[model samples]
Target chain A: MKVTIDDVVLPGDFCEDIIKAGEKSRVILGPGLRKELEKIFITKAGVLRKRAPNTYWVDSYQKRYVPARGENVIGVVIQKAGDSFRVDVGGSCSATLSYLSFEGATKKNRPEVQVGDVIYAKMLVASKDMEPELVCVDSNGKKGRLGVLNDGFVFKCSINLVRKILNPSCPLLNSLKNEWPFELAAGMNGRIWIKANSMRETIAVGNAILGCEYLTSEEIKSMCTNIASILAGHVS
Target chain B: MTTKRPQLPKSVLEMKFMRKTRERIEKELENTQGHDSLYSNIITNEMRHATGNFISESSFIFCEDLLEGRLSYKGMNPEIERLMEQDIKTSDPDGEMQKDVSDEILYKKMEALNKKRKSNDTPNKNPVLKKKKKF
Candidate 1:
């Protein structure tokens, strides 16, 4: 039973099916139950036809942005302690924004940022064995876009949705381009907090968010509305 | 010339972890590319023989020499269960085929799962314990 990418089966399912089929057929390849096996199999020829050399295989979930070194990102301040604030990017770990890393700090004992601030930060290092390190300071040592997030709603969305919102050509951004003027901080550690004026704007931005692998803006907006209604229903 | 493995600094461990997982998955994919069709079929047949059922589309299928059963998605098919429930309700409004599983072994498993779910639903008592900040 040869499986291909186009085999109607989900990629994860196909991978597993092929592995099972291969293992069983190793010693003896005779008639077992054709219909049972055929249910999972598409065709070996179909797979061969569709196979492309440049094709890259990934997990069932598409990759959005997981913090990588030298990549510039926007994050939200989730927790504050002493001289540093924990910023949730869009991955598993939160980025740290130190008071000393801010633009102009005359004293080491100065208050800089508190929780719930959506700020722009830069990734200094991204590694597997250690946590990702981020700094707000630029090449010129100037602090930019570091402050408390005011007048906005925090949206807990999939990391891919954050990518869709940040995507330049996302229809949600285009449709509400001038309608809603607000700052968006998409965390690399898997959280996005949007600060907007009205509930309408927040909802509009939320509608544009998409994840769960490959969806158009219209589909995402409908999902957002449905989800928002459910949440609203629960609260009310 | 034998090349020595460079010792990475302790501060950059996270970078190394991502690289390792990425490499492992990629290597698996690469190794699978060259194997013959018979390899996957053999593994599939043995599992089906043992389970007496076909594997679901969501099952994680991997073969590493041993054809022995390690894990399964037996009770994880929620979507199929929902469909089955709806079918039962439609065909037999009296719910004849909707008998609950009363097998002692299965009952114990379900009870354990319920306990685990209940425990997870409860939030940690001490939510605000401070730890050293890892960069």
Candidate 2:
């Protein structure tokens, strides 16, 4: 069946708008969208979504993380190899993080990355043929928020939920940001690393984020206010 | 594209400024021509067509411009908050508005650049390369 924007799309279904746009110029086929010999087809069951200027994808509820290049992800250092550590980003295979990829790392001075340490990193090379590689530094060799995440509670959620809260227009973060002091690192791989000063505040922030997954923006705002009031002792 | 390399116009090849590039291009053409003859039977048509036009991105972060996940709000983490503020400042529309040069001047400069690029793209249209004038 043909699907339009925001319509529930299934595997084998195609979008007329994408096909029409593909004929004119190069079209970006994001996740769940595939190009065949003559037509483009949907590969996942989800809502057809389009960003401005010919970007198309299916917003499917997914938990599994397929590593892609240039995505910031939170990962766990699982194993220490000769010169690199194996970090699991909830993908099909563990990605390799070289010791030299960290900021100011050198032959004599190795970065102190140990096993089972949660790290916020970027996917540097994620090709199908080779093992995925993670880097903690950018081109200028700066960490830039991509480093070991310390004292944070990491949790798992749907990839869509991560995208939802990270979206600029989403009220989930905006509504609750100023209410309390907290920090969060959301990985494209569906892992969330959160930290707060107090245990109650941490749990409250986590619950607020997880609760708003299926809520409307208006409902999310109200829920934020409710949580804020409860946290502030104005409400039971 | 085509395996055959386009020859540089005689005028460009004769210029003293292009002697180094001309030598490099000649050497590259000579090397590739030799390799093509040697591997003519080994290589196939399908090998060249392996790359495709469509780029498939598996993650939504690129298609949807998302904020950096590691963020601190209200001074929870001062370092992270500083970084967030720096990001906001860099991406702020007001900062973008205060450019080194206005768009009108930039557009005029780009128009002159396009004229040079247009001539380069169609080398066969002109046999001689005329020197560009400086303002």
Candidate 3:
């Protein structure tokens, strides 16, 4: 049950390397890595990954999302509960988004959020025992791209795919961005909401994303071109 | 038990005029000792367990240097693109600024333009004023 960074780690696996580094300096134990009595234990079965400057995590393939604090998520407003809206963020229970949490929202003027509206929000509180909370604004009360996602097609994918596409080195978005006019919002909770000028472009964007999930950078580039050409009615 | 706060000078603590301040400092030291002794017997072995120095993060954004997923490119959503541009600027403050013309070239261009204007308009109208303006 002993493993190092980048190894296939399982539950109960102890990482002494992380513990030793933690003792020397400040170390960040990211998702799936826990500290227990001078030993780092893995809680999720996945490949243990590490970032520079002592940050470590486990990359597990997951579809069911366990909400975490401070992660941006796409959710649908399920119900209006007095001062807050209950959102289904693909978790066990729905998250609560207060009307006051929205920018410029007050008790007199609640943000007009209708039921079934897809929204891009930040996870404000995500505890195991309590229902997770979502917020539409940042610390400075600015909406800043966190708000109701209007008129976009929402699709589900594995949480791993979300991280892969969001990664800076990923060529999927970079190669497809300039191909057409499209807007995309990928939630950490494994949902992508995308909008484009036409239905073909939107589907093309979504298919490109879903197709590049298991592709190399070069393959992804070619796939994007193929999608773009096919959508343009050229049989390439 | 290892206090990082530096202790005051012995002579300063012993001064007659510094009686009140010295008493307060002595009280603070004694209070720390009292706090330790008060809980010494109450702390069980389980409470003293070293839980290591790792912090569990729940989000993949920090683990994977991920870009903000919300994006608008090719004039899709002007508002989202504006926010993205702002984020890019804040992340690299000097990137857009570095693209600006260098100060040396700007100064040289301004001087040449000023000489041409002076020649065309008032070649010797205010010679002293022009010299002082340069300074």
Candidate 4:
């Protein structure tokens, strides 16, 4: 069937629209869409989304974290194994982070990672049968914006909410960033860590994010302002 | 009746008493025949014309397609903000609002800078020379 973009799609729904688009050029089938013999099939129930230049994906609401390769996730150090640390990333299985994966970590110099510490790391290898492996540093051997998160409150939300807030076009962060000075780290595994100068400000940031989960872009902007004012003790 | 063996190239066999060359050619022919019989059942016609584009399905989402989850405002966690600044600098090294300076504009700016430097240098040199001359 010819399903247009933003249409609510379900499993067993075949999209001939992608085949037509692919005829002209290459088409990328992102998550939830798969290519069969000659047709494209939807594996998950969600709204079909198409980005510019023939990229398509299904935006499905999910809570459980299915480890995928190359995704940065927030994990808590659960156990220190022989040479690796087991991290609970809210997934079915815990991921292992090699001690040497950190930036400048060598055999003689191991990274100071303790149990119960939250670390934002990338999934280096995530396979169905094998255990997911995580790395702290990027390909350039530099820890660019990924490492252990310190002194922040971590909470779990729906994975869809995390995706919504992390989207570049999302207005939630844009409105809140200017209102208060707070730091936030949202992991794809449905975990968010937030830190601010005071506990009140941190709670405000967290509340604003949680409140905007179901609101539209316009509504989210207004909600952010309201939250900011309330936190500032101004009822207006 | 006995089956006749395939002959080597006349040019190679015609070489003057080259015993090693003839033996090598015979060995190569035997090896080719042995290989054809050894794995003839395993090799498929489709394997010879395989395309380079092999599509492997993955479940992971690319982080680049999404925005950075970590963000800081004002002076909250200066370390994270510094990392964010570095990320922004590296993402668009030339910056988002970089003006497209053409070759003509660059040359004009260089010429103007040179003119200003030359004018300043001449004045400074003249004063020093005048002081030396007075001494």
Error of 4 at A138 (Å): 1.4
Which tens-of-lDDT digit does each residue in A1-236 have in candidate 2?
97888899999998778877866777789999998755689999988888888899998999989999999999999999999999999999999999999999998999998899999999999988888999999999999899999996999999989999999989988988898889999999988989988888888899998999999999999999999889989424
| Per-residue lDDT of candidate 2, residues B11-129 (tens digit) | 98889999998899889869968998899898877666544546688878878989889989888889988988888888875753657998899999999999989978898545444
What's the distance in Å from true for residue A69, model 2? Answer: 0.9
Q: In model 4, which regions exceed 4 Å deviation?
A: A234-236, B1-64, B93-135
Better of 1 and 4 by lDDT: 4
Task: Put down candidate 3 lDDT per residue, A1-236, tens digits, no spaces.
Answer: 88988899899999988877887888887888887765778999999988888899998889999999989999999999988899999999999999999999988988989999999999989999999999999999999999998897999999999999998898998888878899999999999999998888888899999998889999998998888778778523
State the RMSD for candidate 1: 32.4
Give one digit per residue, the lDDT tens place, for model 3 in B38-61: 998998776787444556777887
- Taking the tens digit of each residue's C-alpha lDDT, what string does model 4 give over A18-41? 778877776777788887666788
Q: Top model by TM-score, which number?
A: 3
lDDT of 1 by residue, B48-113 (tens): 565323322211111011111111112223333344455547766765554477578798999999
How high is the lDDT of residue B134 in model 4? 95
* Model 4 chain A: worst 10 consecutive residues (lDDT sum): A227-236
Query: What DockQ class does candidate 1 belong to?
Result: incorrect
lDDT head-to-head 1 vs 3, winner: 3
What TM-score does model 2 achieve against the real structure?
0.76
Considering lDDT, which of the candidate structures 1 and 2 is the better prediction for this target? 2
Give me the runs in candidate 2 sitting further than 4 Å from their true place.
A234-236, B1-53, B95-135
* Top candidate, metric lDDT: 3
Cα misplacement distance, residue B22 of candidate 3 (Å): 26
lDDT of each: 0.48, 0.88, 0.89, 0.84
Question: In angstroms, how far off is B118's CA in candidate 2?
Answer: 44
